[model samples]
Target: MTIQTNICPRCGKPTEEGLCPQCRAADTKLLACEPRVTAVYCPVCDSQKRGKTWSDLRMPREDLIAELAVSAVSIHEDAKNLKVAVRSEDTASNRTACTVEVEGTLYSVPVSETCEVEILWQKEACDRCSRISGGYYEGIVQVRATDRKINAYEREVAASIAEQAEESLQQSGDRLSFISELEDSKDGVDITVGSQHLGQEIARMVTGALGGRYTTHPKLVGEKDGKALYRVTYSIRLPFYQKGDVVVSRGGYFEVREIDGRRLRVFDLQTGATRTLAETEVERLLGNVRDAESALVVFTQPNMVGLMDPKTYRTRELSAVPWTFPVEGQPIRVLRDEEQDRLVIVG
Candidate 1:
């Protein structure tokens, strides 16, 4: 093959190919020098792929350490807080450990940032989030960070959790599911429950346990009887006409009383086997209450989140956070609206 030379882009030098010496030294030329590659194919095109690049400290090591030490004064801590340090004697080795404090509780973790404390990494701050209060429809803040890897990792985790929450809602027979995507984090995971009233490490633990999935969505589109319930689209298991019994529906359950006009009555499957509900009560029996399109379902048990009495198309007054951990026998939560382009999950 014959080699060709072209004018360098940054320098007035006649060089082989294109980029100049200055650009190469600026870490902008190509990874042919860095060894990092996003792809092994198409060498020239692949080398231009952007990746993370750490910055260097302009101050002396002593000053850098002192600055970090002083900055720690306002570090809001939690169960994962750590006391990090590298003594003067060990400065040569650049070793350190972590001591954390959260909610007045302390714990030690094995962590070391010794080697060369990347100034770029030190520039990062803890992540913060704000979520609405009450119910699963309320979105939440996970965390915030400047590092690309941390951001990517947090996004992936949030996606996994959101995906699970949606699935749980569907399986539980929710009317509709809608939601926004999750945020990133540099400190730790943050999440909100229905109404945004509660957010804590428990959310993180739940997210992790459920393979990073959970939601605060509620049952019944609106609030009733003081609490938000899950609204759903489901079948009403109806029974033969009856006199007096409780009816079940995809939305919730209700008791039947007296019949009115042209209407068919249904009976309860339980002890009130032959009892029939009134026409007005029949309407309640087949109630598929309006759902707020959240993942939270009203059910006494997690399983109940999916159950509805066919005999009366009625459901119990209950809702769930839709949590699941594959490592455990628990159910999984998948947010229905996480798909980009508003795509739906099938099979």
Candidate 2:
């Protein structure tokens, strides 16, 4: 068999293929170099911009460089049936680069080449971080009590729920959701949120977790784009009496067991019966269990149970409730009513 040869059109050289060896090499060299990849990053917050939203970095820097490098690679238009893969990627503090191996058929001939992708990381502040630095907030969440001051427990719960909500929202790709500041004051605990919707969400979460009500008040701050833009304020009000608190109402002392919606389930210290009080009727709080103490039972009679006060060491007889049948030497909680000069059974 004899090898067939053809003259290249441009180079006018005899070759076994369509183009001469020199022409093929020249054409292959015409393939453009890899374009520079750019990544907008917020160094302060460690966030990367994905499309229009700024998101926290989900992958390691090297892996991110590999992905971005592959995407930024531009194959020559003449090179059909192209395939490229990242062979290796290296990243530094402010820069990332990757080596990609490309293989494809160009003009009915197999062509292979390697390209370097350099990702220039531009350090800048994200939109949310910039606004936060400026003290910008679209809404405020004020945690308060319906009938009394906010307790330490309630404040902690509300703040924790708000923080968790922020994390949840951010992980869901909500770039605008952010908490600007959390302030504790004499009035109440205030949470400043970057977005109005986030503020509303935090208020709902606090109310839902702690069992309370919320009211939203929108104040017209200004107009934007021919529309009214109002800043919102969410007032989250907790119940007047939390569970395990001792309250005095209608000359009767009770220990709050549960706040079931519209009713308060309490252990009536006066009658030793579990009773329900309309939450609306809880006008004031007299005292709590902080002053109560456990007393040791000395003996029991038909109507009264004798007990020794741990503090005063004084022996006293108190009317026993039907619900409680104290055994000898059993300890029971009692509240001292100094005005009445008597000890009241609590629980």
Candidate 3:
């Protein structure tokens, strides 16, 4: 029988096949890095652009720099246990210089390589920024109260809700959804949005928190990319009676708790019970619970409680309710009924 042994062709060393591990590893290129790579970003919003797509930067600057550097490097397919280290510095205002070092095993032999890569940063306007600067909007939300103008508190709530909705949508990757402008008009607050989705969200949230309903009206604007485009206007009307209002209904004083259309869910101050009343049954509006006065309790009886009137500085007796017990020498909440010349216990 005859036996044959394989030998390395280039080094004349004993091997399995054509070349030994050390010779093959020496001949292979472990890492190849491009000399330069361009990074495009928005100057206004700092959004990064990659292959004709713009996205918000979600990584730190150092990590992003290292990623850009490593992206320009190509590793050999036969390399194993590869490790890369990158160091970068800003060479100019829009330029960065990077050094990449790679260590790995090729064909069972350790190999290492280092390369230099330069990154050129270019700035351009992003989609959202461009639309905002151009005063482009797809929808408007108009907030108004029923039969009256919106108050300062309502206006503030609307504006705050709009801003929160914008932030939520932007963070959820809806880049085009943004608030273009928030304006306060004579009637109410007007919120202009870049997308219909943002406007709808703002209107829904405002009404949900402020007790109101909204209606949408769409107008044909034009056509884009063979699709018909329409601008929407969301009209929101708040209820007449808001929460915390103290109103007189059917010869009884009640505190408004919630407003649902023409009906109001109220707490009966005289009986300490919760009941619903129609808006038309309300006789008059004395004041809101927010305007209640702090009266010092002078005396407490079995059927009555005596309190010092904050305005008159005199002791006044009021029929006590079973809901709240007033302790002597403590302050109790009272709402004044000017027509009846009396102090009504609020709590």
Clashes (N, CA, C under 3 Å) per candidate: 73, 0, 0
RMSD of 3: 3.4
Q: Provide the TM-score for each candidate, comma-separated.
A: 0.17, 0.66, 0.85
lDDT-best of 2 and 3: 3
The C-alpha local distance difference test score for the whole of candidate 1 amounts to 0.32
Tell me the tens digit of each residue's lDDT in model 3 across 34-61: 9999999998989999898889857998
Clashing pairs in 3: none
CA shift of 118, model 3, Å: 1.3
Model 1 misplaced regions, further than 4 Å: 1-136, 139-149, 181-206, 209-347
* lDDT digits (tens) for residues 1-347 of candidate 2: 23565778888777776887567856665244566878888888889887777878578866777788888766777777777777554467766667788888776677888877788888889998999999888999999887678877778888898899899888887877899989988777999999987998999988776667889999998988999988899988887777667777787877887776678998887677788998666655646675578999999999999989877899999988877878888888777777677777765
| Model 2, runs deviating above 4 Å | 1-33, 74-93, 102-112, 246-262, 267-275, 279-347
Query: For each candidate, what is the lDDT?
Result: 0.32, 0.80, 0.92
Model 3 ranges off by over 4 Å:
1-7, 10-18, 270-272, 289-347
- How far residue 111's Cα lies from its native spot in candidate 2, in Å, is 8.1
